[model samples]
Target: MHTIFGAGGAVADQLLPILLHSQQKVRLVSRTAKAIPGVESVAADATNYTQTLQAIKGSSVVYLLLGLPYDIRIWRAQWPVIMTNVINACKETGARLIFFDNVYMYGKVNGWMTEETAFNPCSKKGEVRAAIANQLLQEIKAGNLQAMIARCADFYGPIGFKTSVPNLLVIQNLIKGKKAQWLGSADQPHSITYVPDAARALYLLANKPEAFGQTWHLPTASELITGRQFAKEAAAVMQKPDGVSAIPGWMLSLIGLFNRPLKELKEMNYQSDSPYLFSSDKFNKAFGFTPTSYSDGIKETCLWAMESGK
Candidate 1:
């Protein structure tokens, strides 16, 4: 049986049926247990070693998909501790660990980022991510157990929120018929991953033994569409007038005094307004995996927004 942490999140929720379809025995562990078909849910916390050990027992492969609080200060205190718990749990159970990560470890890089990109993080959040990644990598390097890390770009899909572009601005603004505000220049290139793409890449990594001790870029669409272009496209999908727009850095900072989420998002505004292209050639060449079409992902998101009761 495969053990997964953070099953309450959107990615896990979407991945549940897909993993079960393969007839693989699955255990879904989170702090809260909810009913999902074909998978067993357990209420367990990753931060607690005793609870984690119980949740992960008898599972051959364990997936770390946990997240910290939105506050950077809180994250700095929590992420490393969480990683320590996960590492110890793996050591106790001898389970292979698969970590779901993001591009933060690479920080800000010029040109496109590929599998070969090195870590040179700038922001506080990026540094924390780097620490967590190295902890898991070290375990593999030591031959204590097997490990694989999957890095994905900012992805969106149904039930996604808190930091999702569509949930944060696109849909909410469109519903109110108010212009949406964003962090950076709309003209910069940004490659977005569909949530399904993220889940599938992790699945491939778990199934393939060769993936251990190596990092893999999750599947992302080939296109590097700009923020403004995405906005216009979303409008087309929603059949709404152009309601997307940009919010300057100073305003974000000013609003940050009252809004913690926007404040946390402000540090990385440079990437949103600059080119943040992620290359997936490594994953495609390795697992023959290609990402879902971007238009289809966006179309579904728009439909979710339209039908949502608010």
Candidate 2:
């Protein structure tokens, strides 16, 4: 049996069909049950050890795909506790763990980032991520659990309605025939991972024993594109005439004064202000999987956004 914790989010939502198609016995655990056919949905809070243990019982593999809100205070208070509970539950249940992670732990980097890059978290949220990731690794080393970390860049694909960049700014704006907003530097090259590709890669990694106890960057498209380029391509795909414009940091800060999420975003502005590239060469070499090109990804994303908007 394979169990997915925090299964209501975009990544888990994308992963569900893939697992179902394989005829795997899958359990989806979250605060509320999701109404998907051919899967068992269990409502449980992962921060509670007893509930997590009950949710993960009889599972061969457990996916840690939980996501917290964009508040630093909540992250600081909840991440470690949730991680500890999950780790303990996995250890007790003898379920192998696969953690879905992002690139925030690496902080700002010069040139492309790889799995081997050092952790130099710049913000409080980044520090929380780094700490939790390191704790997972320590547990693995201590022979308490078998696990792998599958990390991805900022992602956008089908069913990604709440994704940060593409959904909120690019695809939505283009679908509405409005000018797209770009965060920070619109010209800096940024890496993005297609959600479906990430789902496929995570499934593959879970089945491979050799991938255990290691961190792997998921397959991302090889070519890097700037936000302006992405928006332009998306606009063309959606047949919109409006162009993309950058949202200055000062403007974001002014908006942040009243909006908590926007205020929290200011600490991570360094990522958008400079070029951020993520490398998945190791994953490609191991699995021989190529990611969907940005053009194709954008086209599919636009279609999903248009359909969902209806």
Candidate 3:
């Protein structure tokens, strides 16, 4: 059976249908169970070793997709514990592991980032991410586990208003008839992953035994666009006004003094302030995958928002 540790987020929601269509027996584990047809739902806190072990038992492949809250204190306290619990559980259960990860561990990149890019974390959250990722990599390198890390850039999709920067600041704002906002520099080129593409890549990687013990940058469109271009295209797709205001770094830092989420984002402004290019040529060439373009992705995102009332 295929087991997912965190099952209610955007990627998990997208992954569920793919797993089911492939006729894979699926188990979903989270703090609270959500009733999903054709899948077994289990409630277990991953920070607790016993609970995590129970939830992951009897799984062929396990995905660690847990998303912690944005607070740094919570991340520092719980992330290591959770990683240890999950790692030990997967090891004992003999389940191959797939870890869904972000690019924060890379800090700022001068050009296109590949899987080989060194991890020099700039923020506290990035440090946390680097730690957990290293913990997994060390296990993989030591031949103690069969696993891989699937990493993605900032992503946006139908249902990730809270987690996706573009979805929250641009797409949803436009959908709600408000002026879209761009963080940092609107002129800097940015590469944002489409969530569905990420989910599809994960499924492909999980099924291939040779894909284990490596870091893969999930397939993202090769063509990069600036923040202004992204906002304009999203607005065009929604048939809304194309006016977006860029929130300067200083302004965001000031506002973050009161807003907890923005406060958490303050240190990561380096990403938006300059060109953030990501490359997925390894996965693209390996799997013959082509990612969805920005125009098509925005159109579908707009349609999904209107249809789902999100």
Candidate 4:
């Protein structure tokens, strides 16, 4: 049985169908009950030890895909507690764990980031991410738990329309026949992970016993493109006139004064302020998997935006 602890998240939502297609008995656990046909649903807040343990009971494998609110205070206060609760619960239940993570802990990298990159977090949020990730890594090193960290680069996909930066600023704008906005520098190349590929690679990693007790970067397209190039390609796919406006870091910071989300985004501007090249060659070679090309991914994303009216 496979249980997803933070069910209803973008990644967990994408992963559910894949697990079901493979004939796995699934349980969804979250703060609120989400009723999915034929799947067991448990309402539990992960920050509470008893609730977390009860929600994870009887699971053969557990996927920690929690996405907390994007606020520094919230992250700093809740992240560690949630990680501790989940780790202890999984340890007691003897369930193999898979943690879905992001690249924030690496901070600003001068080159392409591989699994071997050391944690040197820059932002308050990055520090919080680094701490929780290390909490899990220490257990792996001590051989106290069976687990692995599956990390991904900045993601863009059809489902996470609201939270995805590219979707909110670029794709959705292009779909609406308005000039798209690019955050940070438009010339700096950035690597983005496609949502479907992330889900597929995550499932593959969980099934492989050898993948446990280590960190693996999920499969992402090898090609790196600048924000300007991405907007151009997306415009071409949508057959819309190409035009994009770039949002500098200072401007984002200035706007953050009035908007809470933008204020939270101020610290993460480093990601788009310069090149963010991510390498997944380790997972690609290990699983013999390839990621979806940006051209195709953009086309599909554009189609989804049009169809869903998002």
Candidate 5:
């Protein structure tokens, strides 16, 4: 049986269908329960050790896909506690673990990022991510738990309503017939992970014993495109003629004075200020799967956004 924490989130949403279709017995755990055909939904707070233990009992694999509030305070206080509970539960239950991770822990990378990159975190959130990731690695190194970390670049997809960057700014603006707004420099190249591709890659990694005890970057399109290019392509897919507008850092700082989330984004603006690339060569070589092209991904996402608004 496979149990997925944070089952209602975007990644989990994409992962569910694939797991069910494969005839796997699945349990979906979240703070609130929702009914899904062929799957069991359990209400459990993963931060609570007892609840998490109950949720993982009898499971063969546990996928940690939890998403906490995007606040430094919340992350600093809760991430470690949640990770500890999950690790202990997995250790006791004898379930293999697969953690869905992000590129934040890498901080500012000068070139393409691979699994071999050193963890030099530049921001507070990055520091927290680094610490949590290291904790997982330590458990694996000790032979206490079998685990793999599947990392991805910034994500955007059909179900990305609550995601940052593309959904909140670009797709939302396009749906309203307004120019897409990009943070920092729009001309710098950046890589984006398609959500369904990420979900599939994570599932694939879980089944491969050789993938354990290491980190794998999820499959991403080979082409690196600028934020401007991304927005223009999205507009073309949406059949909108209006172009994208690059929001200067000074303007974002001014707006951040009253907006807490925007204020928090100030520290990570370095990602957009320059080229950011995350390579998935290791995963591609091992799994032999191709990621969705950006053009196809943008078209599907825009269509979903438009239909979802209706």
Candidate 6:
């Protein structure tokens, strides 16, 4: 059985239904104790060593799906505790860990970032991520435990919440019958990973012995959508009211100075404003995993957002 942390979060919500259908026994852990039909639920603090160790014991694989709150300051307070606990838990139980991660560690990369991208984190959060990930990799290399990493790009899913860039900004516009807002230079090429595909990629890697001790980029639908084109497609999907305006990067950066979260996004202007892509050729050749098309995924997300009354 596998233990999925952050079970109440968006990614887990998207994953559980599919995972349950696969007939794999799962233990869901969250800050709040809630029941998922046909799955065990455990409420525990991820940063609490004893709680984490207790929850992790006897589980063959653990999904390190924990995410920090939106507050940058809180991340500083929390990530170390969580990583220390995770490392200790893995060491004690000899369980393999699959870390759910983002592309932040490959900070300021100029082209399609692959699994081989160097860790040159530029943001505070990126540094924390690099530290934790490298520490995990070191532990694995030391033969203390087994580990794998899956890095994803922007994401959207059915039970859409505040996790993805589009869901955070675009859904309101679609729902409000207004033109959606795009945060950066739309002309910059962007790759958005559907949340289901990200979850699937993580799950597929769980039992693959060859997958251990390395990192893999989640296969994502490749779309060369500039922020403008993406906004156009999203607007079409919702058929929203016209008069959409592009929110410029300078404005976002200006607002970032007052808002810590927005400020964190300033460093990522390179990604949101530049020609960035992700190459999944290696993963495809290795695992034969093909990502769902962006159009299909976007259409599904549209129907879901519209249905959710968001």
* Leading candidate by lDDT: 3
The TM-score of predicted model 1 comes to 0.95
Candidate 6 Cα errors over 4 Å, as ranges: 241-244, 253-260
Candidate 4 per-residue lDDT over residues 163-280, each given as its tens digit: 6888888898887779989888888999999998999988899899999999999999999798888899889888888878998878878888898888888888889888899999
Off by over 4 Å in 3: none
User: Which wins on lDDT, candidate 4 or candidate 6?
Assistant: 4
Q: TM-score, each model?
A: 0.95, 0.98, 0.98, 0.98, 0.97, 0.94
Q: Candidate 3: worst 10 consecutive residues by lDDT?
A: 156-165
Question: Using lDDT as the measure, what is the rank order of every candidate, best first?
Answer: 3, 4, 5, 2, 1, 6
Superposition error at 215 for model 1 (Å) = 0.5
Better of 1 and 5 by TM-score: 5
Query: Candidate 5, residues 64-136: lDDT per residue as tens digits?
Result: 9999988899999999999999999999989999999998889999999999999999999999999999999
Model 4: lDDT equals 0.90
Which one wins by TM-score: 2 or 6?
A: 2
lDDT of 2 at 114: 99
Q: Write the per-residue lDDT of candidate 2 for residues 175-271, one digit (tens) a residue.
A: 7678988889999999999988999998999899999999999999989899999998888877888578898889889999999988988898998
For candidate 3, lDDT tens digit of each residue in 1-310? 9999888988898898999999999999999999888899999999999999999999999988889989999999999999899889989989999999999999988999999999999999999999999999999999988999999998988866978889989988887889999999999999989999999999999999999999999988889798889989888888899977999878878998899888888899999999999999999999999999988888888888878777
Better of 2 and 3 by TM-score: 3
* Candidate 4, superposed: residue stretches over 4 Å from native: none
Off by over 4 Å in 5: none
Encode model 6's per-residue lDDT on 62-110: one tens digit a residue: 9988877766678788987898898899889988898888887888888
Worst 10 residues of 1 by lDDT: 159-168
| Clash number by candidate, in order | 0, 0, 0, 0, 0, 2
